[model samples]
Each structure stands twice: as structure tokens, then as C-alpha cells.
Target: MLPVTVEHAAQTPSIFLESAYFNFVLKAVYHATKTVLAFLQRDSVLYWPFLISTLAIAWLAWRVGSAAPDPGTKSSWRAFSRSHLSRELWWHPSARLDYRFYVINGVVFPLLAAPFLFGEQVVANILNSLSTTAPGLAAAGTSTGVVITLVFTVVFFVAYDLGRFLAHSLLHDVGILWEFHKVHHSAEVLTPMTTFRAHPVDLLVMAWGGALVTGLATWLFHRFVHSGITFYTFLGLHVMIWVFSLIGNLRHSQVWLSYGKTLNYWLISPAHHQLHHSAEPRHHGCNRGFELAIWDRMYGTLCVPTDVPGRLQFGLGDDTDGRWRSVGRLYLWPFRLLAKRVQGALQARRA
Candidate 1:
């Protein structure tokens, strides 16, 4: 239901990096230099930016949480409101149920996934190459290797996020995909807990797409640029996304403030993303940018209504099949819909 705009209206920034297939060797040099520099400096440069950004982001979270109106009471005359430390979140039966899954989907899955990605073979290949490459890269400088990895990681994240933003936008715009996406928007109230209340199938699809995009970016960056990989450096790719999620926990709270309404296009603000969660037709799929708003702006999916009342509701319309109201139902509903569709198609052809 996102507002349809003219094509080419969103002239997203053109990707300026050198060709992916041919730039592998130069990227290796960048990686080697960055790794050496990071080791020598103990990642001060890396951690400082993260620390400062975290603090600034934390302040932003507090501000936004304070702004959310109380949805429990009609007196507030606003929508999607909750306290930063809403007792209801910690004790709400629905919240608790959602938390169990969040832990598995967010923290546990990430930890379990590391081993698979950083398995023996993957590590061995990178380590073997690094032994020889690091020595030469070290000669360049103390933090040269670190610098290389840092730059590569940033670029990788940009590409990965770009892909995610575009794909998610498509999911909302495409009728077939919207059926599943609607499950996510079906939340009646906004809370930190609501952030993780996505259908498991939706989570799986998102996780897989993210992993695929990151992996492809990493492998291409390492093989062609730095000649190898450094796991932490590679991890730095999604560092912003992780931070965004950590901060995003605050976005749905009653507090609300937006810094980069225009600039944060690179890093989506809570206010910016909130609009997307709105069930209203115009708001739907509007703020499709995940970690960054740039893709939305560039692709014309950006929706910033400076004048409209805040999103009044956060779920699907009356047509929701109450059967999928529970956590288990949300997960299984997609498959059931698909099955019904397939059956209908087969019967129609036979008839």
C-alpha cells in the first residue's frame, strides 16, 4: 500500500566502488593494511567510533522512549505508545512468550550461526593466507591491516543493507509477499518486545537473506581485495545493523526523536522506521530501509510525513484470521496459506 511514485524519481546514489570481479587484489591490500594497523593500535580507532556512536544512540533511545504515548489508556489520544521500562513488557504474558523466541532468534541464532560460518575450513583458508599476507601487510604499517578491514567492512555493510532494504520494500509492495509481512504488522501495541514478534518464517527469510548478502560481500571483498578474511573485520560489516537493532528496541517505545531524518538515510532512525509498521495503506512499505534510509530515499520508498498525525494503529485490518493470533499460529499461517493456494490451483486446472 506504499504510495506509488514515478519511476526514476528515486535516483539512488550510484555505486562508485571499483568493479567487484576485478578489484579483489586491491581490496586485499586494503585488508592487510587495516589488520596490521588494528593490531598495533589495539583497535582504538575502531572502538572509539563505536563507543561515541553508542552513547549518542543511547541518548536518542531515551529520548524516543519518553515520547511514546501510553496505548493502554485512551486519554493519551495517540497511538503506539509505551514506557521505556514498561512493567507490562517484563511481565506481560504475550511479552514473555515473545521474549523466549527473541532470545532464540536473535542471540542464540547469531551465536549458533557463527560456528557454521567460521567453521574450520573457512577459518583455515583465511588464516593460511593471512600468515603470508599479514607479514607483508604489517611492513606497510602497524594498523594498515585493520584499516583495510574496516573500510572493507563498511562497504560490505552498505551493499548488504542496500539489498535488504530493496528486498523488504518489494515484500511489502508485492501482493504475494504482503500476506506474510502482514503478520509482522499485526501487533496491537508497540513495545521493545514487539520488535521481535515477527513470524518465524519471516525471521528465517530475513536471516537467510542477510547472511547471503553479507557472505557474498565478504567473500568477494576478501578474495579479490585483501586476499583473505579477518573474521572480526568481516563482522564489522553488520555492526551498524546490530547497533540499529539494539537501538531499535527503543524505537517502538513511547519515547520518540529523530536525528537523521534526512542524513540518517544511511542509518534509519526509530521515527523513520515507525511509519513502516503502520497498517495504514499510505504508510505501508514506505520506510522500507532497514539499517539505513538511503536505499529508501534512493529507491523512492522513503515516507516521511512531517504533517500527518502519528501512526494511529499497528496491525492488519478486520480481515485477520483470528486463528493466527497466537505465536504458534503466526509461524504456521504462511504455510497454510500457501497450501490452500496450491490446492485451489490444482483443483481449478483439473476441473
Candidate 2:
């Protein structure tokens, strides 16, 4: 009996190691790692390769074109790079927490939500309904001409930018939603990876909004014109790839790249985004557009960048409670406060 029991115990570890649950965990970890790496590609703001190249080019151009002395005594470029492109921000404890949230939001949650969202089916149904009511809308899927495709491409770009602008503005204006969005503004230092330092809730909201806009635009184009063509691509990326390669990463960096007041009316500059992260109350709801400043200008939310760069501080003001800086607290405290608010409402209703 003793020998039999000993044999069974010895086999237990092997059994557990080979179990389905263990394999599932391993698979999840592998996929999460892959997703994180993919997002860190040069095209992405989270990575430094493209950003560093862009900075170097800009620095050389500035040195040759401008008469201003180098930005500092020793090496202004070195100081600028260290402050904004530091590995400290990349491997920071807070950034690790953000990466975990990115995995859950970008991969896990989407998989879980697929059944409920039925995004493909929803878009298909909407297209079908529109086609039935408006026959011209169905014409978009018929043609494969270059001219038609170019028009659709422009339409999609405009629609996407508009949708993002609306969603960003709402996140700032809505008090309850701002609680989740504030997680992003809590950053003390700005790095390219700081772009990913968003709460899962905020990510979900932005994604849904973008999806809806893109879906609607596609349907409209298929109904009226034709599907878009990608003619100008860099490494199979859209034409907009150059935008990211050139200036997107700078938006979240310490570097100030102003488009001037006139150009800023049409386009968003790096300095404009930095102002968005400014701790000042006046800047709180300004410059909400993602790619273009057209929406902000139309909606009266545009705050043009100045020639003189302001001394700006980031993060929520007066976070003396410390919850804003702590990852665990940031994730949990908001939900708890929400729950209490719900409970209070229920009690008041009953009374």
C-alpha cells in the first residue's frame, strides 16, 4: 500500500505539468509576447528605432538650416535623447503594468468580447440595410478603378480622423469616463511608450469608436464609389506610415516640434499633443484630435502651438493620495468608487 501511494504521488507532478490548464497558460503567455513585440515594431510609437532615426535627421537639418547655437553646452542632443528616449521609461515598473494592460485589452479582452461584439456581422448587416434603402451605396463594391479607389481612400482617412477626434473629446468632457482616461495623463515623464500608457477601458472605447467610423466609411464608399487602393506604402504600410515615421512618436516625447500656428490649423504637431498632456486646467480639453487639427478647429477645441515653448508639467494635479501613481490602485480604486456610486443611487431610489 505504501509503495502504491508513493508511485501515485511521484506521477502527480508530471500529470499537472502536462495538464490542459498548464498548456493553456503557456499558450496565452506566448501570444501575449508576440502581440507586444508586433506592437513595438518601428512603425509603432512604443519602439525607438524609427523615432531615433527621425530625431537624428531633424537634428542635422536644424543644425544646417538654423543659426542658433547647439541646444546646450556639452551636447543638447544627448540630453534630449536621454530625457525622452531613456530605457528607464521603457522598463519602468509602471510601464510593465501598462504592457500587461495592453495585452489584456489588445488580445485577451477582444477574444472574449468577439462573441458579444459580432463586429463583422454588425457591419455586414448595416451595409445590407443601407444597400436596400439606397442602391447607390451598393455601387462601391462594383468597381476596381484607380480613381475611384483613391477617392475612397481619402474618405476613409477623413472618417477615421473625425471619429477619433470625437471619441477623444468625449473622454475628456465626460466626468466618469475621464476617471479611466486620467490613467494616461498620470505619466510623470514622456516617452514614445507613454503612448501605450492608457487604461484598458479607454482603449476599448477608442477602439470601438474607430471601428464604427471605419465600418461606416467602408460601407458608404462601397455604396457610392469603390473600395480603396493602397498605392503609396512603406513596407506594406498605408501612406500614413510616413506620418508616424516622421512625427507621431515625437507627439509623446520631450521634443517640441511645432507646425506653426497656420499649419497647426490643418495638422497636429508634437507640441500640440504635449499641450494636451499639460497639467493646466485651460489645456485639459484642448487639442483632442489624433491625426488632424481640422476637427479641433471646427469644434473650437484647437490650441495652436506657440513659438515660445512653455514649461509644462504632466500628470493629474495634486495626486497626494498616491492612487494615481500606483498601478494596483489605479486599476482597482476607480471600480470600487463606481460600485459605491451605484449603491448610493440604488439606496436613494428605494428611499
Candidate 3:
């Protein structure tokens, strides 16, 4: 949480000095490039198939006149691209910053957060060892074992999803955490890369929350009532996650795809997420759940797309202007703001 001090800022010029520091930065960038490219893998929502699926859905929306006032699905690719991928949208400064974040955070954040991650099996074993009795479901492959796996897989998915919702809600509701989380809300534009436009602290909170909940749920299941949902995998994630990810990338894009009123109440549509990013006051802090609308519905943060059909602005409040556009500021300002919060709290305590 060190501040980007005057002395530290002054050293920026040394980056071009051709010294060991420059070489190190070059190596980091090289690895980071590869990391950014890895987003195309099956495990990622940015995988080619998933992105293509998103485009297909968006195209369908255009054809049905669901995306805009006029249907353009019948238009040429050039026309569609001009409308959806215009320079004013995709090439906007805010989205450019997201691209930078994806590259930098890809290599840096994982290395920083690796030590804090938990291995699910290891966590399950530890939990089992602490108990006096043997715990675990019937071994894999038998009829009973198959039943245990099938039932608990759904349980594991729900538990993991709940964890995601809880973690996201906290990042929005908690003041101290919200400063770091602002890096995400600062995006004035959304793209698939916006999925990776997260601060490391934000990412850490999500990763830890997922691991802890899933790990504990797995342990409890392994004993019919002890298991990890890791047994089932589709495209490198649990079946639920994989299914949700089919349109997950669209959540961070300009497409206004909704599952309509009925399903929207039960599941999160990309439009549910778009409303979450709305700059309108009422939309702020709404629609925090990733896959389920139940949490938002229970907590009363749900905002169905039909509620506001007019044009919606994105980003933090208008005062932000372009201050968050700098990649360096996006990374450093969270620490500065957080430190200021701590300092102010301490001063108030003394008074």
C-alpha cells in the first residue's frame, strides 16, 4: 500500500536507461503478452467459441430489433461492425485502458496472488483430518457414487455461485474495498476485456471467496454429505460455470441481450450486468450477482433491463472525466485512496 511518492515518480525516466530494471520490465512485458493471448483458451470466457457465440446472440438480437430501434442483422458485416464496433465505442479511451489492464494484470496479479490461493483437495483433506471419523462419499463410478456426485455437483455449483455473489456485493458495499473495486466501475465503455479490468485486490477477494466456499462445500459433500465439484468439468470449469460463461463475455460488452422478464428473475442476463454498469443513480450498486438473480432479488438490487430502455451512460460519476484513463493511475491511485481512508480514520480516532 505504498504511495506513489515524488521520489518514486521521479524514477520513471530511468525506465529507458537500458539498465537491469529496463531488462526486467521487458521480460515482464514479454510474459504478459503471452498471458493476454491465453485468454483464448477454453477455460476463459474470452475463448474464440464463446466470443463467437456472443456475436451470434448479438446478431440474433439485431435481427429481432431487440438490440436497437432498427434491426441490422440483415445488414452487411461492414454495417454491423460500424454500428457495434465504431471507433467511438471500441476505441474509446476507457476501453483502451481496459486493454492495458488486461495485459498488465494478466502476468502481474496471478504472481502476486498465488501464495494466497487454496488447493481444493488439500483444503478438503485438512478438513477431513481434523474430524474424528472417516468422511467421503462412496468411491467414484458406482451407482450410489454417481448419484452422490450428481447431487453434490449441483450443491457445489450453487455454493460457488453464492460465494461469487457475496464477494461482489462486499466489494461494492464495503467502503474501504470499494476504492480498489472502483478500477472496474471506472470503465466508461465495456468490452470482453473488461472482464479482466480488475484490480488485484478485487481479483484476490473473488478468487479467495470462490476457493473457500467451494472447498468447504466439497468437504461437506465428500463425507454424501463430504465432496469438491471438481469431478465435473465442461470446458475447464464446472458445468454451471461453463454454461453461464457461454454468454458471460457479453456481460462486459455493449450488446443489450436479455433473457426477458421471467428468466431474468432467475438468471443473470448480459443486460442485467449492463444495468449494473449504468451511471444512473438508481442503477448504482444494483445487479451484483454473476450467474444468479436470486441474491440480487433477495437483497433488492436487481434491475431488469426493461426498467430503463433509454440510453444509459457507464463509468463512475461524471466528475471522473478522464482521470482514470492512465494505466499507471488505475494501478496506483487505489493504494493512495485506500491509504488516505486509513489515515483519515486514524486521525478521527485520535480526536
Candidate 4:
């Protein structure tokens, strides 16, 4: 104790360092395994894992409010109006309305746009250019491209979300674009699926607009800068897609998660998005970036007021309950607005 040897202390630190290194390796291996498991869960036989994870998340949410019967406060074992926070979209009364739009916007519009977006002539032109430059790429064959295309399809979905944010900001700020896109924000209820609950025409325009801009940008990036997409492009995109989906859902939830401005770059964080959906004019163009805050920052449309709470209401100025809120009405509302504008213009000319 009086004279501790350097060798004795060195032995402990060496052992401790070795132990820490082992723990780091173990954690790394565990995370790698988890990622692989997640990728595998997309297969047919892996449905059980997917189902289990979904149930687990649902159970986790339930557990937060699953208290035993209380003594004094009035409550019923057979509850009718459960807390809004506890209920999923399917259980919500207006959920069907939301899904109705989603089917039309996410599924229908995408399919409709595919012909125009990936037309044979367009495809041939694109492939011919790539084939001319990278002749070896053709040898990979249709199967390789098909497999690659399957992966790109997921990227396109992610890209659409990013596009929607920009398109949304434009809808509010730009004059004519708003005429077409206003139909999306016209919704009374904001839900996770609300992102997909867009007017078919608006959906088509925004999807194509963003796709065109993004595809061209990506082509330039791959063609000029990198000569091809980097692994990080795919990895970063995949990570951001999952993150945006998770955060986007919260933006729709009644309960708020305010990240202020710190994590806004990493996430389109729910709190800022809520500000965008606000009925307040000040928050009209807030949180414009879909996946990256950089877009909002670059365009100077980002809004995050420190003094006021992010919680705000949503509903287009012309909204009428059970009227223009239906899926059919959503599609027709723009046309009606257009017709009204035309009539007013004619009257003004006569006057």
C-alpha cells in the first residue's frame, strides 16, 4: 500500500482497456446483427418478426396508459372515448377518410404518373444515354437493373416525402402552385397518413415536380460529381426515410414533441411541422424541408418561434364540415375554386 508498483497499476489499466474494447466489439456486433435482422424481416417467412415488432410497438404505447382501476376519479372498465393518444388511426372515427385519400394519392397518383414519368421513350432515352457512356453497365442485364430498381422504388418513396415538404411551402407561398396544392392543406384533421392524403392532381404535380428536380439533381450528382451514387447516399437515405416516418407520425399526433431547433436538421421534427400546419399565418411556411432542414434554411422559410407553443390548428379557410372534406370533394374542390375564379373574372370584366 505504501509503495504501489507501476507494473501493478499498469496491469489493471491494461485489463480495463481490454475489457472496454471487448464490450465495444460486442455492442458493434449486436447492432450489425440487429440491422441484418431488420433487412431480413422483409421476406415472406419473416412476417412473424414484422408482426411481432408491430405488436410490440402497439403494446409499448398501451403500457404507458395501462393502469389498474383507480379509486376516486370516475372511470369505466368498458371505455367508449379512450384517450386520443392511446388510439391508433384505424380506431379513429375520421381514419377511413384519411385512408381514402391515401389510396388515391399514394397509390393511384403514383401509378398514373409512372406512365408519364417512365414512359418507354423516356426510358429508352435515359438508358441509351447511360448505355452509351457506360457500356459495361448493360452487361449487368435487366435482372441487375430490376433488382436495383426495386431498391430505387423505396428511395423514390422517401424522395416524395422530401418533395412534399418543399411543394407544401410552395403551395402556400407561390401563387398559381397554391391553387393546385391548396387542396392538400384543406384537410381539417392532420394525421400521419395526411402526408399521403393529397388531391390526385396535386399529388401528380408535386410528385412529378419533385421527382423531376430530384432525379435531375441526382443524375448530375452521380454523373458529374461522383460518377455514380455513393454507398452513403443509399445508407443516409434509408436512415432518413425511417426517421422521417417516425417523426412525421408524431407531427400528426395530438401529443407534441418539441425538439426546438437543435435536432431540426437531423429530423423534420414534429414540433416544427405542427407549426407549419398551424392556422396562424406566421407559421404558414414553417418546416418546409421534408427530410432535411437545410432546404428550409436555404430558402429562408423555416419558422420556430421561441415565445409561443408549437401547438396550432389546421383547416383551409374554405373548409366546410362533411362537404369538401370527402375524397371526392377534395378532387373537385380545386375545380370549383377555379370555376368561381373564372366567374368572378368575367363579372369584373363586364363591370
Query: What TM-score number comes out for model 4?
Result: 0.59
The models' CA-based lDDT, in order, is: 0.55, 0.66, 0.79, 0.53
Q: Clash totals for all models, in order?
A: 34, 5, 11, 0
Instruction: Select the stronger candidate by TM-score from 3 and 4.
Output: 3
lDDT of 1: 0.55
**What is the model-wide C-alpha lDDT for candidate 2?**
0.66
- State the lDDT of candidate 2 residue by residue for 26-83, as single tens digits: 7677667666785466545545556566677446534542212344422465654554
The candidate 2 region of ten consecutive residues with least summed lDDT is 65-74
RMSD of each: 18.3, 6.0, 8.2, 21.9
Candidate 2: Cα lDDT at 94: 54
**How many clashes in candidate 1?**
34
Candidate 2 regions off by >4 Å?
A: 1-23, 39-43, 47-49, 57-76, 82-125, 129-141, 227-234, 318-322, 340-351
Per-residue CA lDDT of model 1 for 128-184, tens digit only, reads 466554533322222337668677667766766765665576567765566666666
Per-model TM-score on C-alpha atoms: 0.60, 0.77, 0.84, 0.59
Better of 1 and 4 by TM-score: 1
Query: What digit string (tens of lDDT, one per residue) describes model 4 on residues 46-150?
Result: 234433443343334334432212223214323312433245534443456776665445444544455655422243346448756562322322232444554
lDDT of 3 by residue, 1-351 (tens): 889887776676664365667766876886676676665677777777788888887777666666664544445666567667789988898998888788778778866777887755666678878873764455343334666667777877888888888889899999888998999998988888888888899998888777777777777776555333345677567877787777888898777888887998999898899889888888899999998899999999998778436566888875874689888888898999899999999999999
List runs of model 3 lying over 4 Å from the truth. Answer: 1-34, 71-79, 133-145, 224-230
